[model samples]
Target: MDEDNWDKLDEEEDEEEGDFSEPETTTSTEPTSNDYMAGAILANGIIWLWLQSLQMFSGFTSRISPSILADFTAVTIVIAGFISSQQVAKRSERNQLIVALRSALYSWAGSLFMMLTSPNASITFSLILLVCLLAGGVLGSYMLIQMRINERKRKLQASS
Candidate 1:
């Protein structure tokens, strides 16, 4: 460009640069996994509490027998697994399937606790829940393996 145009452009650039905001600096650089886990747990707890409040308002729990409650508990555990999966997804796609599977295992353990506490609940139903839990775990593990394989291929391509 002409000398005058170049000078005008440089002046405009300097003016714009002077108007820019300064970047903030902090000491903490990385977020902890516990932070994500805490958020997930808090969200799930709030949802469960809401469900309980609904049950109270409708008198559903009182109308239903302990058997129904047991079933509801099982379903709640499954829902928790789903929430955990979502939390993992939010954190990162890598190893997400594995994290979700581990969460499913945690759900199974929670349901097992309820089953053990209830005297009238059948062992058979608990076994069925366990089977479903294991199935989800297996599927999650398979996905995790696939993710690992893809990651390896990516690394190989980058290196080559």
Candidate 2:
């Protein structure tokens, strides 16, 4: 057969033998609840360590008592993270964002609760928590909005 005909034949054979062995590398480019959980765990852990070091070296274990509530909060954060991560894996970016927002809200609530319930939680520490929560909310909201806008633009472009 001529070179051109030979090439056509090869193409036809390739079409029949499907490339089924190639795994679909599906990934969520968006960060999910599980990501939040991981970050919270890390941050909380660092805080815990810092607290511990201060107590050990400086003898400043003043008002922060290691309580059941603290453990519960940590567990809750992890659980929320897990739920969000699952949503992300299912390609639910909005749900993931919702979970993140909820977590931030909860953090704010927890901070407020701490301030009211514990006399030892200093004003300075409370303000720091508030700042952290505000920053997280702003950043998460911005990301969510951007994702939504981008998706809308893509759909419009595609339809056009």
Candidate 3:
């Protein structure tokens, strides 16, 4: 009887040790609604700051060739969209394309705000910026997600 009790105690100790063994690592990229909202807010803030700076340096912009400025602005918008939406699609490696598209659309609301408020924006320029933002957001997010190097391996996040 004593030997049986001792054996059971040993087994319990082994079970406890096994249960507490090294934490397993898994990718916890499942994005939440807050992630999307955060992306949108980040995008809006970036556009707002960019617009403010452009207004402050209106003279500099005016001196530059309009075509050059337009192209530069398009590129900037795309980059902004990409960066802003990155957080939203960081964990969506399997569905990066769709996530990227949705993230871009959500973040593009800020750009839309800029378009509506711009006193002198031409239709051509606005359309160009729109397309650029779409391309940037989707392309950037997809690339980041597809690249295994950028994947977030979480061991503790799930515990918390």
Model number with the top TM-score: 3
1-160 per-residue lDDT for model 1 (tens digits): 6999999999999999888957666554332456445534543464357456756766656776778766666565455555554444444435555565555555555556655766666778667656555454455446556767899999999999
Clashing pairs in 3: none
Q: What is the lDDT of residue 154 in candidate 1?
A: 100
By TM-score rank, best first, the candidates go 3, 1, 2
Q: Please report how far candidate 1 places residue 18 from its true position, in Å.
A: 12
What C-alpha lDDT do the candidate models reach, one value each? 0.58, 0.53, 0.73
Q: Which stretches of candidate 3 lie over 4 Å from their true place?
A: 1-28, 113-126, 149-160
- Model 1 per-residue lDDT at 36: 44
What is the lDDT for 128 in model 1?
Answer: 62
Off by over 4 Å in 2: 1-105, 112-120
Q: Pick the candidate with the highest lDDT.
A: 3
Native-structure RMSD, model 1? 9.6
**Model 3, global lDDT:** 0.73
TM-score of 1: 0.41
Give lDDT tens digits, candidate 3, residues 1-22: 9999999999999999999999
The total number of steric clashes, by the backbone 3 Å criterion, in model 3 comes to: 0
